[model samples]
Target: MKPYNRRLRILCLLLPMLCLSLLRPVPELRADPSAGASTDDREILQNSLSVVEIDREIERITAQQETIQQELNKLSGQLEDKLLQIQDQQSRAGAVIRSYYMGEREGLLVAVLSAKDLGSLIHMYDVYDMIMEHDRTVLDAYQSEYKEIKNTKLAMEKKTADLEEMKSNLIEQRARVSALQQKVDQGIASSSDPEALKKMIEEFTLYWENVGLNEVKTYFNALASAMNDLPEFIQNQDGAIRTNGTTYNIDIKEDDLNAFLRSKNDLFKQFAFHFGEDEITASGQSGTLSLEVQGHYSVEEQPQNSIMFHVDKLVFNGYELPDTTCRQMEEEFDLGFYPQQIVSFVKATEVKSTDKNLHVTLKLSM
Candidate 1:
């Protein structure tokens, strides 16, 4: 008896069906109330699983396109090399021809002048004539070969161009797939946790201008610094460490870890907006949003001065906040917050250390 890998078996069964689904044009829906309900239900189904399917298709298509592009690029490079080689051969042939025919002393004249005796002069003339004839033959052959190579190169270039066009079309298709996937994913994410969605939007507004800042390189560097300070923070009660009064155990798996990273990245986008030296405006089919900081110092604004700040710690909703006397703002607004939910800039303090720069940790509602 063989062990069953259910997911693999389902995927194998659905492979053909999935391909068939892609071939059919999407159907149109009626606009009645019942039709609207059906549409909503269908949307939920798409949000749940269609987005993942679309992502898988996109990955497959993108990989195929990349492979094709690499092959086309290689063929184009080889064709270009062949063209250069042909041109070089032609140039060498031309130089040989010029030497034999266009020099001040022709081959015949040089041979006659160099020969000492009559028989030797006759043999030299014959040899010079034979050499010139051989050179002509070689030049003619090279020209013919060069022409052939040129024609072949043209054909290959046409083929490469066709492949590139095909790749471009495929890339466009992949973009469509990616956009659809994002829409479905967003819908699912929104339905699952509206609070988290709001947090993502708010954070995206913060460091929106710092697309470069969200790089893995910077993330890793920041993470390194944070990790290095962990020991000292854990030692002191006033330090950055937090304790739940009991042993804290997490139940996250690998997939959850990946989701956490994505959520973290989204959170990073929120921080990026806070550092906004300049306003960033992005408009998509779904919506338009803008992020800007009101200050004299604009980082991307190319201002003369730009303020730098570091986040010390994050405060989520309902946590024991430093300002115990302060009222919770979200409660007044009737907005509920949750764990891992990012909030707005509450009261912050400037680092009293040497630099005297400001550092803020956003306060969130749980």
Candidate 2:
């Protein structure tokens, strides 16, 4: 089916099934920071960049999955047809074997061998040639059919696996985005005094411009260094690993990451990161400031493949900053990464955080 046609069919039902979020009334703002989250507890209700962008990201992933599914279904149909072809080919091959065993083929061979005169021998040889031609045609067709089915099945398996992985990433993305949206809403709710909030946002923005990028990069660099600690994918650009397969996974334990980060950066000596099921939360003292950060890894396909870790929620010195501050910080800084040294070998496609580890998915390429 055409994409627009599927969209049209879905659109037809939109009126009947209105989204609950659309029906939701505007929420009243709460002045008490405790109403949403707490500053004393180091829980910061930081705002997010356009939540709509995250929504669009979800839609894009869903659409890509749907397209892959359609291809899988088409392959399934082709596989069915190929199976039928194989059955027909098998039956033809069986018939030829049965005829050969039943003496029809042997009779021709006997006559050809027993022929005495040149004329008789030539005639018998012609009959034998005709029989051989018939068998050869059946066998050749069967071989071709077998090859075709094998290729199709391999392609189907690859597509199925890719779809499943992408689906898992999609689910994780939705959960993380939902958490980010909640943070944004909470940030807005905590904005009791706009003038004071504006001043705080300005101060935070200035701080990020002056110090955040260097500190965050140092922290992120530490995380990247941690990737090397993983047993798998710890290879040179031209390493023997993943030579046959085009994709690989890197899963690092939470404790292992923390240990490596602290080792890499002394500022993170007291820092700790918790890789949740779908999000990453960290809090610690870097310099004299105690910072609490909420973030997630989002994959980017354009301008080269990379995973970007964004601080969608942040609390610096026990203040819940608004989206204005977060946006400026985000515009100037990016914390996530890919193995640049491996760019000659592979590219990262997706990432998902689990309670056990941060899972990065990469695809090998020239």
Q: Per-residue lDDT for 42-61 in model 2, tens only?
A: 23223332333345557867
> Could you say which candidate leads in TM-score?
2
- Cα lDDT tens digits, model 1, 278-337, are 222111110122122111111111221112222222222111111110121211221111
Model 2 lDDT-worst window of ten = 28-37
Angstrom error of the Cα, residue 280, model 2: value is 23
Task: State the C-alpha lDDT per candidate.
Answer: 0.41, 0.67
Query: After best superposition, candidate 1 residue 12: deviation in angstroms?
Result: 33
Runs off by more than 4 Å, candidate 1: 1-40, 43-57, 76-88, 99-133, 148-167, 182-366
- Prediction 2 TM-score vs. true: 0.42
Candidate 2 collision pairs: none
